[model samples]
Target: MNALMLAVALATHATPVSLEDARARSRDNVQALTAALQASSAEQDVRASRSSLLPQVRFSAGASLNYIGPQRSYNVVPVEGGGFQQLQIDTPEVRYPFFNLGVTVSQLLYDRAVWARLEQSGAQLEALRGEATEQQDTSELEGINRFYSLFRTQATIQVLEANVRRSEQQLERARALFQAGRVGKAEELSALVNLGNDRIAVVSRQSQLATDQARLSTWLAMPGAEAVEAVDPGVLTQAPAPAPSLEQALQEARTRRPLLVALRQRLRVAELQESIANAGYLPRFSLDAGYQRTGPEPSVFFGQPARQNRVNGGLSISWDLFNGFSTQAQARRAEYQSRVAELNLQQSERELEGSVRQSLVALQAQIVSAELAEANRKAAADALVLAEERFNAGVSSTLEVRDAQLKLTQAELTLLENRINVEIARFTLMRAMGTLAPGEAK
Candidate 1:
């Protein structure tokens, strides 16, 4: 039956999508893309923070006009010649246009606050990366859910159509028996009613399938109008794996979940923030150097002999003595925020453990249900066959056959639903354990 269904599905779909394919396409989901952009922005922030520790270079040029008053001469008496003499000594030029060009470089030698901020930015970058992974995993899980929903609806439609065909045959048989005087008009009417109900069910399932297909298409970042066909994941045909212990699942979740990891990184960032606030009590050190050239004209600014060259270097230190208690307030705020982060981490861990337990229990129950549903389906099929034989032998009424057929159809749908539920539960468990991402071990 599985093989037949697979063959029919392949023949009908021009391109059927698999679970892995759906997960792969989830990278294009809006949330995933947004997370990626956020991570990229955080990376730039880290670079900006680190740049404060590196050398900064700048170039400057300017020109200005100058003015000075006229020079005055002094009269002096010579000791040997008893006569007054006017003495005019050489004087430096006082009126000139000035042109200056300079290059300056500055580097931070020591700054505790700057260093702490750099570390905080690095932690933020890591936290954002983990968040991006978490978003990608979430998107992939959503894609998986949509794929299975579409697959289940498609399979249910097939079962309903088959039931309709069976009803048609029953209707024909009843008509023949009535003409032969073996059965009354009531049997024919009942068979007709059954056929109508089956057709109605098929139509309902078809509508659901269309909705599911569109949902999957939109999630996979395809055109909204495009139809998506899902290939069966074949979970029913395979043997179920042993369930993991709740403790083991919790351990894995604690170590592997991106959300938890991101939270831990945020805690580190908060601690670094506290450090940065406390660093206000420490002095900062830096190095600065510059070379300048001045001339009376723009052309001579770059000339060798006409330019007055200057080279200077210095070390700087700055310490904040007081800021109206702002630093103390900031430190207190940072300490409280760090405590909040710690509390959040604790709460998240508890929630994660609860999720793991619930998922594991649900998965185990679904697996058992799938097994029982398969057995029920087989029994229903056998019962339907017996009822049809009895009806042909004239020992049973068409109503008996119709009831058996309905039971079989219902059993088939139940089995299909249980099988799909088992798969969904397993994926949910994997997600809880943070192993749902593509290429991760399940």
Candidate 2:
């Protein structure tokens, strides 16, 4: 309730707020920092993957029961007294218990395309980092835009309310004149109708202002938030130097823009994938070691007997003989993907160039528009004063006075909106060139 009351109060006494302040408040938001964290985590994954190139060792120790059904041959050649002529018969299988221990070591020796994949992983990691950075910037830019929009709405609503008051005062004055037999009754009725219409406008604008405030709250993720206060959105002015040149903007984008960096990194990853695929046919080498021990105890060899340990170690190599051209096909596919990535990169470059140039052009136009709005607002103010003076002296009709008032009101609102639009336009240019400033994160 207190916040709402404060918001209502701001409707009447809003103060000037600088663009820098709004951006700073938005940056302090927590959401922005969360995005940065997500990016850092993704980069960590890439680092882990890259570390796979290092050698790895594993130790295995376990015990298992092994048994075959016991088997016996009736006609066995005995060393002492053998009966070769005896009928031969075989019993069931044999059973044994054994324990094994081994250690395994594997190293990523050079082969087809593993390096390429590692490089690709690095690129992917970089891309994700860039994505996070871009999101942070984009989120803040949106907040700034909403801030300005909210300010404009608040200002316009105030102007409309003022119009309503002015109309009411005029109606009162016209009624007095009519009662004195100085003006026709029709004039008073016209004033009454105008006042009603102005009041209606005030209500409509206030409704719009509420809607804008709700949207701003949602964007800023304000917790249990109240309606937005009307910010002053201070003077409408252009950056001192207007927009930077196209070349400079593009250069900045190349170095500073996250999306651009991400795209470039993705392309590099694709190239690495191509390399990895081509290397798929290469041979791979690995080392292994283990130990084995066997006891002469046939009783021990049976499932009920005790077991012994074993250790063994060896080096092994496997070279693929053929895969029916599968590897070749995969390499070709990777090559095609690499080409596509390169094309996309080129497209990004061209689009960025146009975007930067277009923003610069719009910024220049707003400068002119802002100056014109200022001059028009001043002229309208002067016109209203003169018309009011003439009507008081009985040298003008009510129609002239009303028209002058309407024109002046329109001019004032126009000037305020124009100021906001110009500010938004400057920020738009900043965003286009990937130069939005940092703000507080919640």
Candidate 3:
């Protein structure tokens, strides 16, 4: 099948795509990219949360102009050697400019909520990473299924075409025998019918191939008219490696499956959220320091000696005290969420165990089927040869030979199909066990 795909690719001068290429292309899959982006965003959230534990510095500057109206002033002026006299004066209008520049620094001395949030964010990031990996695996599997399905259809078409050619040859022989009076009209008619059926089968197989190719093009993100050829991985003909016992597979899945790992991380994240919620009942403390300069001009920040300059530092604590029972309600909700996460993890484990068992059984059954199919194909080939010899020697009828030919074709197709099925089963079992290679498409 792989050879056929490569041949088609070479004949058409189209770039041949292998399973590895499909897996690589899966990196650009939309769902995987979205998960990766989510992971990246979560990482930023973690950084932002952790930043609360570090000192933060901010610098600010402002300038304002104030206009003042004329003011009346009262004063007592003293005479040279007499009593003081009262006087009145009107002051001119004036404009005043104010400017200030300051830098403020704050550090989180102790805040349980911020610390809990940081921990939660880290766990969420890990969960998103796992999700991204899952999406990648899913995309790869989708591409692989499409590729192999197309391969299967193409192979079937090849078989049907060969069958049609064989039937045509048999029909010609039947017609010649009929004219020579060695066979009757019925035999020739039967041969014609067989040839027509084989042609129909070829048409059906071709249609199936076209459909599979169209689906594969969607996975490859190519134009509808683009040709895609899959590399034959030779998995159908190769003997698979020994699989582990059911118990071993389950154990491996428990430790290695990305979904399980991600779920565990989510559980931890939920626990951290609960902690964060409970933290609302506790007091938060921090340290703050600032330096400031103020004057009538922007230059007062640096050059004006008359500018007021000051530095201040302080420690602060905030206790929520009460918020109309909202804090208590949040704590309860978080605890409930934690419980739900635990339950979900348990459910996932149960489902995963079932899947592993089912896949193992299916793989074992398909292996047996492949062995039987091979034996059947050999028997059918022998039968066809014997029947053809009998017909040539005039010891048996053409109907017997035609039946044997049909049986041989069916047996060949069955063997090939079963071989592919076994390969698919092997892949499924590996996926269930969480042991599939990173680069290999499912």
Candidate 4:
């Protein structure tokens, strides 16, 4: 199929579109913005993690009315008049109202676990950034592919339209010649058939172009995007150099894949988690201090009364010797998680190797295909010129000319396809090798 047919087949029923609009729409679309927000969320997570390590303070204050139930009787104090007589006692409820206020503060002291976790959070943040970048890369890559695809479809549509016009002109000439008795009924009939075939081809290609446009618009996230015209592929070109060496590409992937980096970050976090869990076995310490004043202190309604003042402070320590195996179970789970992270990192490395090899192989295939298409295109052009010359000289039939023309058009389309595919393959190789950035060129 010609480029337009390919595009139309790919698109929803629609007209053509311009390349610039498609890219612009994609950049401004929901997908791009969503990926950006995801990165920001990861950064916020890191900030929260860092904040966890900072000193925290809490204030406490409350007022209460207490109906002090019955005071304790004084132990035996002998009265001088009664000598050893039993002392009389009175028990009465005491009522008092007071307010208490204080502030408590705690600062992180020596916590190896905390330091490890902080570092882990930092790594995790970086990993998230990488993932967002990867997402952008995927979008951009798909955009490039769809963009060129649209170009091919537009080219094919042009070819089909031209062919239909040519066929109509041929049919008109044949009818005129027949009316003048310069051509036979067979010639007129053949021209009519050719015209019908060309019209059918034109209709099919047009339909296909519509489909390609719709698909492209959807990909660009421009739901309302209309038909756009594509520019002619001015000239064919090749990558500036042979594909980078396989070893070089593999190394790049090892360091570049966001998924791998994310796994590595998790591994670090798991190490930190394990450390934090182990810290449960160690003692923790805190300090508290306070001051208070009690007894009647010159109330607004009462004469000045004696008051008692007091101050107190203390250090506290805590340790958990054993749980019902809960802490131990948690520690074991963390260990298993750490192991999983390590395994993932290893798997990523292996896949990176395979990707590099596969990309190189695919790149080679495109190069060969492009070369073959180039040679075939030249041959088809020559054949087409010969067929047209023969027809104009009245030495060949219209059927022969049309067949040659079809072959020529098909060859050119194939060549166009090969060129675009080569570019796509190179782009893929760059991604596989990890050399391509995750975003548009700066």
Against the hidden reference, what TM-scores do the models get?
0.88, 0.81, 0.88, 0.77
Q: Write the residue-wise lDDT of candidate 4 on 93-203 in tens digits.
A: 987776554555565555555666677777777666666656666666677667777677776666666676767776776677678776677777998898777767766
Winner by lDDT:
1
lDDT of 2 by residue, 111-221 (tens): 555566667777887877777667767777877887877778777777777777777777787788888877788878888888877766766666666676666666666
List ranges where model 3 is wrong by over 4 Å.
Answer: 1-15, 71-91, 175-181, 240-242, 297-302, 438-442
RMSD of 4: 5.6
Task: Give per-residue CA lDDT, model 3, range 1-442, as digits (tens).
Answer: 5434544543384446777777677656776778889989999999999888998999999888999999998899998898998799999999988888899999989989999999999999888887777676667667777877877876777777788878888888788888888888998898999888877777656556557767787677777666666677776667655556898878877876777778989999999989999999999999999998888865655587665888999999999998999989999999999999999999999999999999888888888888898899889989988987787665777689889998988988898788787767766776666665453212
For each candidate, the alpha-carbon lDDT, in order, equals: 0.86, 0.70, 0.80, 0.68
Residue ranges of candidate 2 with Cα displaced over 4 Å: 1-41, 64-75, 78-83, 86-98, 175-181, 223-225, 236-241, 291-309, 438-442
Residue 135 in candidate 3 has what lDDT? 71
RMSD of each: 5.6, 5.4, 4.6, 5.6
**Full ranking by lDDT:** 1, 3, 2, 4
TM-score of candidate 4 to 2 decimals: 0.77
Q: List the residue pairs that clash in candidate 3.
A: 2-232
lDDT of model 2, residue 155? 75
Steric overlap count per candidate: 0, 34, 1, 14
